[model samples]
Target: MLKKVRVQIVTDRFEAKGSLYETPAGKLLPTPLQDMPAKEDIEHMEMTVEASYHDDGDRVCIRYKESELSGMEGSVTSVSFRKSEPALISMLRDGSVKTALVFEPAARHLCVYQTQIMPFEVCIYTRSVKNCIEENGTLEMDYTVELRGAQAEHTAFSMRVLPVFDKPISK
Candidate 1:
């Protein structure tokens, strides 16, 4: 059986300015800072994501697109699941799951580290289960996802578990 889960994310934050400094040789240097180039009002943004899982339930495929005014608009991000229990266990034991965020449209130039299941981890968690059975014998599922991200060190963006599902009506 194949399942589809839909997720929506919204965020509002200000953009920071880039730091400028002069070196001892009178050369301008750029620092590695996560803040934006300038301070601005919090902009509202939304993203819609779809995740598909195989019948065996060991693998997952995800696709997401985000809309932002201050940053990259209409950006997309994707990831594939590798069947590695040991890797997952190791990540859990280490209290962090770090992975590069490769969403071409949004984070093309940025490297994102996602930590799945650890506290303050920057990652997304999803679960699906049979919710109800229709009178005509159609089964429905309830899907939930918890998403988290960090624009910079010590700055976190979080989306708590929000439930979205598809209900198959009987004929």
Candidate 2:
């Protein structure tokens, strides 16, 4: 049987601003500033995660929805996933592995300007699992998200994972 799951995330938002420049012909050229005037603008973010395993017992499907709230308006950022080896099942069942969750950036969408952008390469890994539970034979895992991108500036954000459950409640 499949169990309905909800994961709650709490995090401290940190912000820092600086400048980047490039030299051409031995002359330094300033790049456009990120201009994040409001410190609250980049402070806090939220994400929703839903995952279910296939009935065939080989593949799993997961989705992530992230939104940032600051200023008077809020925006949704990027959403992605990761994949790992099949050993995750043994780790979870035995409870031997303190952290058994492994994820990869399977798909992602980012809001850029007035349009949404889907970058070709966006990957992430599980930084840590804060909590884990098996209730009514259902397994729930919660952790922190660590973002990774091909570029530096684009890869900066962390969100808490809500308890994501695997379907069929594996024994």
Model 2's alpha-carbon lDDT is 0.28
Encode model 2's per-residue lDDT on 60-134: one tens digit a residue.
332223333322123222222222332132121111111222432222122112213322322222222222122
C-alpha RMSD between model 1 and the true structure: 14.9
lDDT of 1 by residue, 48-131 (tens): 555332224563333344335314334444333334321111111111334443211111122334445443423221112221
Model 1: lDDT of residue 164: 54
> How many clashing pairs per prediction, in order?
4, 8
Error of 2 at 39 (Å): 11
Candidate 2: residue 76 Cα off by (Å)? 9.7
How displaced is residue 42 in candidate 1, in Å? 0.9
TM-score of 2: 0.28
